[model samples]
Target: MLKINLQKKLQRFTLELDLEIKPAFTALFGPSGAGKTTSLNLLAGLTKPDSGKLSLKQKQFYSEKQKINIKPQQRNLGYIFQESRLFPHMTVKQNIEFGFQLLTPNSRKFSFDEIIETTGIVSLLERSPAALSGGEKQRVALARALLASPDYLLMDEPLASLDQPTRLSFLIFLKSIYQKFNLPILYVTHDIASVINFADEVLILKEGKIVGYDKPMRLLAQLQTRPLAAGEDITNIFKLEIIRQSKSRGITVVKSDKLEFVLPHLDLETGGELLLNIPASEIILGITEPNGLSASNILPGIIENIYHLQERVLVEVNAGEKFTVEIVEATVERLNLKKGTPVYLIIKASSFRRLS
Candidate 1:
């Protein structure tokens, strides 16, 4: 476990944090200037706090009163910044070896070959930083961090620089790394979509204060009646098992713990999983069942809550698995939708997008 109780006085506001992170993927979610990066810096010993304590597995990393502060390299915490921050003078192989050489053989948890293979950067090892693309550079950086054999890893929007498709792919790759190594990670990002289907628990930060911490679904449920963040759409993301596929029907069937979804056909194996993203704006809600329609999926549920956005209203529906449906205020009033209003979600089979 990692414990942190730190206070820092920044120009905008004072950052006061009290958190206990377990050995799982925990996300620090917030908008710009929420002090998410500052919190990570404090934990990594890159910055000193005005007061408080920091410890990992009963080892003290910092103590303002005790005048104890561990050096950044000595903390055994790997830090991946927003940029790749690789050395222009070195090749990818040399850059990765820089971190590996810092530790003795006994301290290394993974071999250099293992890190390169796991990150899929073996081919790029001889390439220089200037020759690598955004995603490739991030992969090399990840390999460098893994070679350090750190107790915990800190990622600050490492995928933010990648394009949408590359970012989604990297997210899936990161999930596999977490599963394979079972290492603790504190991932920081402003995009809720990046963490919705990624993190085990989300720690919401607002103006240097910890606003909420819980499972992603439960945390969103608590914020159902209000906007979780400005200028961000609420999307329902799920990782479901592929129960079966119908090549004849051109459809695939997948199921969550409680609900089944019919999606457009994909050439994937049975029992494999797919990461699906259902945008709130793409879902249509109806107060009554309609007759013949072109849509393929319709789910019955009650209106759990309502949130009023600047232009559109977001409705929370409990259809076995909770779903967020977007609609306009005029439609909400026209359909007489409120808490406990029974409704059906109309979704086309092609509306589902595969993230991984």
Candidate 2:
């Protein structure tokens, strides 16, 4: 377990947060200048706090009252920044082994061969950082960090620089490592999609303070109340398994426990699982079925919660897990939507956004 109750004052902003993370992936999510990077620096011992306590399990890394502060090198943390930070002249293999050579004999935890295999960087070992592509360079950087045999890993928007396709692949790779190694990860990112698919718990930061910390879905449902970028809206993510394929239209039939949806032209094998994102504003709610409707999908669900905004009401429906639907105030009264009231959710086939 990792516990932090720290406070630090910077030139422009002050950082204050109290969070306890278990042996799982925890995400620090917020807008720019929200102090997510500063928190990571404090954990890595790259920045010193004015006062507070920090501990990992039984080890105390910092304590202002006790007058104890550990150096960055003494913390044994694997750090991966937005840039690869690889040596320009060194080959990939050399860069990875450089850290392994500095580990003490008794402290050596991971082997070079294991790191290479785990990160799938064997083919790029002979290539220099300059010869590698963006994704390949980041893979080598990950291998180097893992080779250090750290107790925890700190990732500060490592995929922020990659293109869309590369970023998607890297996110999947990161999830695999998190599941296989069970390493405590402190991931800092501003992307909500990344947080939804990867993070177990989310810590929302605003102007140097932690505004909220809870499970990803719960925190995401409250996004309207928080400050977000323009054109950024709430997303409802669902875990689905492919049931069949429509050969004519080249679409995949996906089903969750309680709802079914069709996605455009997928190559997934039968029974393969995937994540789907449905935008809240794209959903339509109706108390009774409309005649001659053109929508392809309709789901029956009950209203679990309703959140009133400036002009819209975000209604959470209890489907398989939970899905959100945005509706207007006039519709809310016309439908007589109340907690525990059953209604039909109409969604167009094109409304579903397929994510890995």
Candidate No. with top lDDT: 1
lDDT of 2 by residue, 1-356 (tens): 88899999977888887888787888888888989889999999899998999998888999999998999888888999888799988999899988888888678776777778888898999998999888888889888988888889899898888765467557767877888877778888898655565688888888998888877766765765643345556667666899999778767888988767877768778999886777888998887766678777777888987876646677888765677787888888887889898888888878987666
Candidate 1 structure quality by residue, lDDT tens digits, 1-356: 99989999999999999988888999888879999999999999999999999999989999989999999989999899999899999999999999899889999999999889989999998999999999999999999999999889999999987766577668777888988898889999988666766789998898899989997656665553454555355567777899999999898999999989999889799999788878888998998896798888999999987866555677879999988888898998898999999999999988887877
Among residues 3 or more apart in sequence or in different chains, the pairs in candidate 1 whose N, CA or C atoms overlap within 3 Å are none
lDDT of 1: 0.87
Give the Cα lDDT of each candidate.
0.87, 0.81
What's the lDDT of the predicted structure labeled candidate 2? Answer: 0.81
- CA deviation > 4 Å runs, candidate 1: 221-231, 236-276, 281-293, 297-346, 354-356
Measured by TM-score, how close is model 1 to the native structure? 0.76
Of candidate 2, the 10-residue stretch with the lowest lDDT total is: 224-233
